[model samples]
Target: MASLVLTDGSQLTSDSQHLGMYSSPTASLVLTDSSQLTSDSQHLGMYSSPVASLVLTDGSQLTSDSQHLGIYSSPVASLVLTDISQLTYDSQHLADWCPLGKDTYFRKFEIYSMAWQNEINLDNVVLAAASYGGPVAVVRDRKRFIKVQTTGKPVISIYTASGRQMSSIVWTGGQIIHLGWSSTEDLLCVQNDGCVLAYDMFGTYLHTFGMGQEAKDTNIIEAKIFASVNGTGVVVLTSSYRFFLVNNVKEPKVRQLAEVAGLTVPPSSWCVISEDRHTRVLMARGSDLYLLKHSEQHAFPVGLDLRENTKSVVEMAVSHNNRHVALFTDLGHLWIGSADMRKKYCEFDTKCPSRPRQLVWCGTEAVVGHWDTVLLVVNRQGEFINYSYDSPVHLLPEMDGVRVLSAFTHEMIQKVPLVVQQIFRINSTEPGSYLLEASKQFQKRSHRSDEYIRLVKDQLNVAVRQCIDAAGYEFDPSNQMMLIRAAQFGKSFVPDIDSEPYVKMCRTLRVLNAGNNHTENLTCGAWCGLVKFGNFWYN
Candidate 1:
């Protein structure tokens, strides 16, 4: 007797003396046996015929019972066994806090286990993630070779940050140059011909706009989506070395920016900075940097007093707040300074001449650069930390931090809040730490609770505040609960302490935690709506 186990936990058993099986092109089968399957010379125990496809996924076994004949496959049959290491739960917690400078700490933590692990290769796709923990969009890169059954039009898929697929659409548009998310959570698809297509979260087509007649004639070679004072803005660089800007996607009035004079080729690096209710473009042409403003008819140079040995700028990234900018040069040096170029923070040499795959700010505190597998985070003072990944990763800059997306996991790296560091940092003694210890001991009904409480007796109010604030920053429910309990324990010892902040934090944490678990509830649009409601309520 022989048995066949399928992927869906179904089993097939054969009672005949000779067991033979065949699978179609779409079917899968697995055979397990400790001994050899002995069959007559005219019969075979298992035989896969022409055009049969057999796949062995993880934890599957295939063995022959008999030395005479165990399993046989025809020349047309395809047998494939995939070997992939299963990720452990402990891998998610491997990321820890690293101190950025004197008082600040940065942490990277896994937010979601990706859903498209085997379905999509991140290296071969164009990815865009919306801010405020919104949905992620992916489309296959047309230039890259991907193995697929069909050669038809590519499919665009939308997924939540946690990797749950939301929607997919058969893209019938022109060649896509870029994919980005707007401030309103609309997916923007930029085509090479300067047409921008907008789609809602569910992949429903909203509207389309064009850059300009000039852009269409010249052809858009590169594009950037940035947050402007008005709304989500788009700026495209044409092949003719010109730029076009639209301050808001909802009302895309294409305006040609002042051209970079004395430039015959595309700039090495460029970025958009939105400030003071206006948007400006900054571009690097060799060792020279130019600032192009829509209001000005000519581009003007922004002076950077570089050493004579400095090379041309290759990449630039602006902070989320638009207050700082980081520039990378061919000499392997990273320059951090104010956005206006008046103040210089520090210049650090990474000694890596190859341009990074992605360079963006991690919140307002550090500049993060990612190559193929190495991630480096450099602070304003030139302090740095390095992280290594085995797979291709993408970086999405957010208001508070940056989201790191890999095929297997989604993670957030950001500066840890001071309140959390005060309580959780390995320390000699912080009042909040003592308060936490007191709360734990009180739960155990130990006399040590009184000792811990007395240690922070004079600063019970401060300890309570710290615990409450720290609870608000923590993502873990257990940590939040323990901190809240610590706050409650300390609050009782303080006389006439206002309970408003603690109560408000509790309500906010409940809402935030629920949104974290159900990511669909806390998107950029949902957050904007909440802010509007809060304003109305306050008024």
Candidate 2:
């Protein structure tokens, strides 16, 4: 008997010998014998010998050595076999990890290669990406001149995080100031006149709202869109330096915040902070900071002991949880402190006078600052890591991490989860590491698999739990399957272990993996449907 392997959606046919067929990881195999075709994992079709023919049109059949055949039918069933050799080594996943503090680590990895790399120019457009791996919207920046001349109206294009274009429309409204997405994934186009036009994902107009009469009269200077307790919120700063806030775009009830006293000019920088069930405005005036609230009659200055040479707070970002704040000053001093301004974490100097083009928080662990081509991540202890990109990048902060969107690629930079560190950290003695090793050796049919399994036999359940948890954090499908397979292997040794987590994780991964393929076409509601279907089928 001869063994044949099929991968990368290839086909194999042999009429001379009885063959044992296998499909490699992340690939599909198709085989035809005597005009009978069988499909298995992820479009995997296999034929056993020339003596027996198996035909599967709406159903699948498997034959054993005794010639016993079993038939299974599912309208939406798909299987994907895992090849351990294709699984990324722990070293590769660990390579990107950078230590944040004594125990914490962060890593940056590419998520998707932009599908619009050749069509869209990041330099000529203003882009905004939604949180939670949502769609991105981009429109031409009228202020930025491109070599090619075009019509007066620019087209607003919406794309998935993978850069697949969903829909686009020609701009026929007022001068656009910013492009953002609501919590429900609607496109919010903030115009210069303080009017925001909302559009669905398919570029259909939904509704519009205005900031206030004063904002429209004065003309909006700048605006910030933030996630609020109620929903997506927008705060606009008028040319007259007054601020207006709408805590929920869906409701669109605009309120004016307290005026910053003695402020005749625009502050160095400003941000919207949603705290204590109310949204407030925080602005930097020279070296002084003021927190403006809608309930208060006047804006109050936040006292801080600054260095004598400190000139201004150039940039600031509040963490996802609104628990920590990072403020960058004119003298290149970066300050990390509690959101309430009660406790100081640390202050580090970047030694660069130029203000960063974009400053945002990566989860609650670090502050990320992006210049033209330099991307920097600074932790609380002042330890920093910087990467230089060939082109400018946009940062979209998420609940767990930040998405770095560039002209050609989409990436994620975030603090590594502890479960992932336990399994992949170099020279780790954790039980999960042994279980992973055991899995790899088991695939190779090596006797060392037994030894590795024995080493962690006492803690098998712990190892299995770690693998399952780590698999949830991994973005790569192949890596996820690897960890999952290790957990499944470990579960076999623990007969009394609860299988709910393993089953749930497997179903969730399948749905997510399927969803990844059609992100451009699927909405949040569609995703929920897929998840519900998965749950129903599993139940």
Candidate 3:
């Protein structure tokens, strides 16, 4: 038998059967094992914790843990329920961990990781990344060998910043010579015949375009798809050693670039930087480099004072902004300077001829290049911050840092931001650093904490913002929590500063840490997803 119940006009029956269902005339009610509910869906609060607490729909919770401590919802999710017996880090602890260099502009640091050792064979992978902390795209490098050997079409996959698999697509179209991403996250697939196809993350074709009749007839030997303020752009190199350009993928405005004399071999490497007025392409030959500014089908040859034995360029990279350019030569020399070469920062040599597999700019502050598993993060000056990986590595450019991807783990190498340095560097003496120390001591009920607070009372607001910005740059979750808590503690003495920034940092870090958890649990294999995003302009 079955029985029905109502709200306020209901009969409470004990034994109608286990299959009984209940309903109210004016409200929609649901029943669980041990809890009762009301019809007001707008104020819903439900949970299954052993402590019998409730979590509201809007993410507020009234749990015993917080009530016992007499504190409201924490600004930080990770620090809310933490035990007091555990100590995360001292205010000065991070200074010893971050490395300092001769680059007076800023300090560089090797970020510790919440990374996982991957099972993928990254040596054969060609990688790309979306700008502003986007996903990484991994494709099998078909040009690594002289002979094309494969059982079937290669696999292209995408993964998040934390290495969680997003999607995998089998390459069933024409041979995939190169894979990149558009500003809006579409994967641009460039083929040998100058055909450019756009696909979503799952590899479903959206649109296609050609690189003009010249590229189709001569067949493209190499091509580069870069970012533009308007949209995605493309550049193609034909077997006949000529260059073709498309300003945007959406409009497909193809233009042929001027030839640089009787050159036959593909120039070592080249990059594009899109500007407000026009796009400029920078190409480097053995010992010479040329800047191709469209509008006058003429390539301007630029002279340089590269070091004696460091000519014969092999690889080159330009920063996300068109402000800086980097060049690598056969003599193991790296030239980093303003795009015009007017302000030469440094010309350091690696002293090896193996040629770096990749050279990329890290947030305009440094250049990151890698060979096999060895990566060197050289600031605009000569400070080299080297990181050794357990397996093959790939560098992905981001707005804040460079994402180092590998079969073993995914990591980030970036400059220790100025605000963070002020708060954590050894002997900083910055008010924010003093505030952090004060917060730690105050938690211990020491009078010394009051003295430290008085030192930074005038600049309490600035101290809070510095800690917030530094927390944004941190790679570790625990470190993020500690710094934020210190900021929260420091702000308590001052009321003029807003809490919104700290609140936002807490939520963003929480989301990032949650993503890290997913990355840690990734099982199966690397062929699951392909991810990459970048912005490009000709320089």
Candidate 4:
């Protein structure tokens, strides 16, 4: 019953009763026995060993071995696959949409008399850009004007939401020099010659003041007429050095606030009040920055001196948010600082690599256009995003893509996307030259697509002949998408076929092959054949 037989090699009887103790060579395999080997490692391709166990390189057993990497990823951060049919605007600089919501905020437009270039007279430059409520008034050349420049010229043009030129005003007299809009009554102030003209946005003449004054010893270089705090149709005047609270004595319908003087100290280049509607702080410019509070019908000056640098402020504007202030110096330095005007945040040397000019913050972003090309956006933290386009143009926001509103004077209107406006918004920080150059580069790249079409012409005959066969030439998967787009658009997509990349793409598409080998699914099939060579494509 327990017979044992051991010859030169190895043998076994089918029914040996004592076979349990008759041991043979012990296999080194650990995971599964030889009989279960197929089940244990069936996932392995082309197994070379007589016996082996499955173990992942990470020391863990893989549940499944079937996995292929996804085909697309974000061009920059994440992949956004847009359905080809849903493309819009063929935007050259299509960035992600800004997350800012729809809230009504004030946008200020400054009208500049760019007399440095072609000497366009200040009066002829229609300054009708800031009329959000009605045709805002403008002071330029020798006249205090209202609503100018419709189709052209020194005429004030009014605009409506329905793309209608609602109203306009034309003045044939005195050169206007300064203008301000009162948010309270929607009134406009036009200071020209030696008088100030006040009017409603509808070209309704309300009142006039300071008429025919003597031009001797009066250092009123810049002036703004604000509305009374009580809003009983009264006016308050502010100048470079003092505040004059005045009302229309002729109309008898005016009220006067407190006219305070001796508020501003000397050696100050520029001064402005805190833009806060309540608790407004009076700011004075001297060798140092000081805060002033208006109370008890008097200008009370505070003794806080914030001395940051020696550069003088030639031009300055506070943000509507009252968070930050921008300063431009005669040296062509664009400096940003806190709303308190205490500390300097950062400074950009905008002096033309040739000559320096002025800096103006047109509400949302800062622009330095007179000297060279520089557009800047300064955030509260003092960081900047700058985009520089190669032209001296003013930027205006085109809200609905239909109506173009000017920032200054709110007068001049254009149809096309204003290059000066949007391009400057893009240049918040120096995008280096590459991003700036890319806008132009896109056009060249689009033209080069034509070359791709011509190169594929020869390959197309063969590809259509065999709609299912493998592509003949060496295939590159990177051009797979380009080939697909080319096939879809055909000759229209690419007019030039002389480029090498196009030739390579055509060869990869198997456009040269004949017979039913070239299939509509040619991209997939071609990618599969090229996968052996480590090139892959995804639709």
Per-residue CA lDDT of candidate 4, range 269-361, in tens? 433433434223333343234343334455444433333554444565554344556655546556676666567667766543333333334
Candidate 1 lDDT over residue span 505-531, tens digit each: 787767666666644534321222232
Ranking by TM-score: 2, 1, 3, 4
Write one digit per residue (lDDT tens) for candidate 2, span 265-312: 999988888976888778999899999999998998899866678989
Between prediction 2 and prediction 3, which has the larger lDDT? 2
Query: Could you arrange the candidates by lDDT from highest to lowest?
Result: 1, 2, 3, 4
Cα RMSD (Å) per model? 18.4, 13.6, 18.4, 24.2
Taking the tens digit of each residue's C-alpha lDDT, what string does model 3 give over 1-539? Answer: 22223222133234223211322222222222213333322132323211122211111222222211211111111112122233232332243343536423333333323233443566666877665445567887776763445677888877755565677778777777777888777888889889998876555679999999988888887888888777889998899978888988999988988778877888888888677747888888888888887576678898888988655888888887778889888888888988886788998877667788888887788888888768787887677767677667777776556666666555555565677656654345677776766776667676767877787889889878877777776655666776788799988888777888888778766655554454343221110011112121110
TM-score of every candidate relative to the true structure: 0.78, 0.79, 0.74, 0.40
**lDDT of each structure?**
0.75, 0.74, 0.64, 0.34
Q: Itemize residue pairs with steric clashes in candidate 1.
A: 35-65, 36-65, 36-66, 37-65, 37-66
List runs of model 1 lying over 4 Å from the truth: 1-95, 518-539
For TM-score, the strongest prediction is 2
Candidate 1's C-alpha lDDT? 0.75
Report the candidate with higher TM-score, 2 versus 4. Answer: 2
User: Could you tell me the lDDT of residue 351 within candidate 2?
Assistant: 82
